[model samples]
Target: MADLQVEVMGKDEGVMDDYIGKFTLSVTPGTKEVEIEGTVFKIVMGTFWIKIESTPSQDKHRLQFPYLFDGPIHYSRHYSPAVGLLTNFNDAWLYSTFIKGVPLFFRNNFQLWNRKGPASFAVRPGIQAGHRLLYARAAGNAFGIIEDTKGVVELLHTGAQDDVSGGGGPNAQRRVKPAVYTYIISAEDASFRFSETGAAFFVDFASKHALHSNCAEVVRYSGEFHPRPEGGWQNFGDFTPDDPVKWEFMIDNNSGTYAPDKMLLPEVKELFEFNFPGLVVRALDREDERLVESREACRAYALKWRGVRTDELQLHVREGEVTLCRRVSESGQQEMKRAKDNFT
Candidate 1:
């Protein structure tokens, strides 16, 4: 899990800004994935509380981070969640395939499992077939970045050539230049506030498992973020019609096998289960102030049902502060008691 914080303090001038910061990056054992947690501030705009995770696998890593806004995303007026998600996702993929996967270069000689037969990190790239040399070059071309490969092999071969020829000629031993990974984050506005930043990492491709296929293996996938989920894991944010916070607050209001009339009810169930252990709620049509009268009538026949305990239960409100005059026995309890009474 990788957690990072990019804070925007205040715009200075000419694509630069005064920024405050708190960044943390953590990786769990047995998994190459990184979990990230922190806050991001944009000058006088707003704040972002984000919990992002990069899960590395035997074949590929995945990232579908969560971003929460306390105030507003004025820039949010027009933006593609899919595009933003994919843009971030491309970084993870590039790391696993092109950057981290560079070790395959040395392994190609023996083709030992093609460097991909065994999953090294989470979501490992499939062992590329063909020559490692060709694969490296192709991967570059496929991603429309072959200059990277040339730089990679040139760096390695240059070092070897230098050792042999002792540096001489147009092919004179030039220092091997490795591929570098740089991250650039920026924010701009009409008022002329500009803040752009960058950081870089190096990649070594002297591995043996490298593939040699001129055809770059480019993979593309598409999926939607589920909201108000009917089946399972839901992602809630601005896009969701249901407010994530409110849904979390009222989840205990409904539950069971079938659908609940309130669209937010079902989704709330997920939020509740995620936060609390157990919740018991009574969904009475409080709009009918005569609820007590109806409960009383139901209690009158509680004995006829199946299980009846104390005839009825008192509503607990204000945490022992207020006690109401009317209440109804739990239906489940009434049914069980009634059944036992009949059996007796």
Candidate 2:
């Protein structure tokens, strides 16, 4: 087959990036299958690449593309640790050795990761280093970030971009600027930078997708996403007589449940645990508590068809110096009763 060439027009505008990827295929006379041999192609301005997908197809072996750096790598969208390195350009560096005979010679584009956290890997991930880290780490890539003496948060042999605020040192809140204007994710249509008022301004990720809405709420630029007025957020909703103090307690307490959903994505849990175990554990515990609370709360609104689904819960208790374990379950309105005890 002739060399494939793919011309990519960046969805953004007035920009073009090319690719030089590689792929393969082979067929025998009367059969419907073709043996395929694929390889890692390159990502450049306008070159074509190929990789043999299912050469021996149940149908004719007629699948071919001669103009793309990659084929069938569709969700080739996976990320790696090198992304963090790019985001944290704080005097940190990365290195790696090329695969034995590949000509690209340790090129700056490819992505790959093995243990030591996404460093200088072949381009299995993609071009943008930060995106790679965000994807890989969030997607639960096991060997994503490996901490060393300097803690570059690297992969293979490359280094990740250092944290912007030097990693929230000391009293953290005091050391770090309140208004973090940047966001972890990037889109051609959006750009984010921190503000001095402890508020963030940027494109709304969820809002931009489908029927979510187009309002770029002044949300907090943390790991999660939440809607707030443009400068910063100071408290949660208040339901008590003394609105101010009550609001403070709500923010300090239960806001961990629904408010922070924007930052804590499903993909970020493991990395969160690894980087900050205590906080991660606390988050997990909070989640579990919320789940239990929800289950009990549901009882108040349960339908007439709702029946008690009795179950055993092994409880570990300590009364003074004594330790006791017990098993418990739901019965009739007991679930609602338990929920009220917890919140009230």
Candidate 3:
């Protein structure tokens, strides 16, 4: 469901500056005969094949299985610091074990999903079994600067002792601090410029659903902005008499099964507000209305080939042609059609 570009670079006259033609490749696992247009070339050993294997499962919310796909899922459940420190170790382990098979978190592959409801804003810790709270705290650094559970527990104890004789009324309950999420953007190269002064940056969207499509549409963003007093623009800039500019942008979800990434919202807002002055930005993850329906359609298309062995699906490419043929247990052969749904 995506297009890939293959660029050929050559060394000519000891300069290594020769530019060869570029060819496009389909995203699906298949083979296709391609022509090299230039000097005379010999075609020797022009055969290759690819196979996709997986244990079929009917769990719609299953984000990942190591035996099926070999990578960690993008989603994780997070707990508030106070609550996390107070949780019992046995209770956490039991909860993780029970929920790992229940499929609470949504699956994310190829693209991110922003569900259309209040659930998108809710955080449920230890809900994803594959990534439990203990694993995240010890391995993934989910608790921010608090590296380990011991540090969190120590902090909680210190706070409780301090609150016992603190200057609040005897009837007043001690308040537990909530976790805060901070956004940090870093550049590897120091010379790289994010934007030019006094210029409007345009956001663009390109769909991966259709092959042979090279067109990218400009994204229109709707938000407010206030001018900075010194020079450049900043979101919620510190300037008196702040007047907000309202702007809107368009989004084309050609890959119907996925939505815009929520983590990128801060970066997107920064890209626009920092580049364009007097722009006040209030950004949210835009969810598609038909996301569930589109996702189900794509999942159905992929699951149709369930129970079929990996070797059954075969691909062969020769002489400017590509063919995907399925082998049956009997003696017959059937040609499988290219995937139309934007699933894989």
TM-score of each: 0.15, 0.21, 0.18
lDDT of 1 by residue, 63-124 (tens): 22122111111111111122123122111111111222111111111111223322232222
Ranking by lDDT: 3, 1, 2
Instruction: Kindly indicate the candidate among 1 and 2 with the higher TM-score.
Output: 2
Worst 10 residues of 1 by lDDT: 192-201
Per-residue C-alpha lDDT of model 2 across residues 1-344, encoded as one tens digit per residue: 34223333322111112233333334223223222222343323233334444343332223432221211111111222232222221211111111111111212221111123222223212222222122332232322222221111112111222231222112212111111111211111112211111111111111111101111222221222211212212331212222112110001111211133423433233323333232222222224654334323322222211232221011122232121000011121354585689999
- Candidate 1 TM-score, C-alpha based: 0.15
Q: How far off is residue 85 in model 3, in Å?
A: 66
**40: Cα error in model 2, Å:** 17
Candidate 2 total steric clashes: 52
Among all windows of 10 consecutive residues in model 2, the one with the lowest summed lDDT is: 243-252
Clashes of 3: 12
* Full-model lDDT, candidate 3: 0.25
In what order do the candidates fall by TM-score, top score first?
2, 3, 1
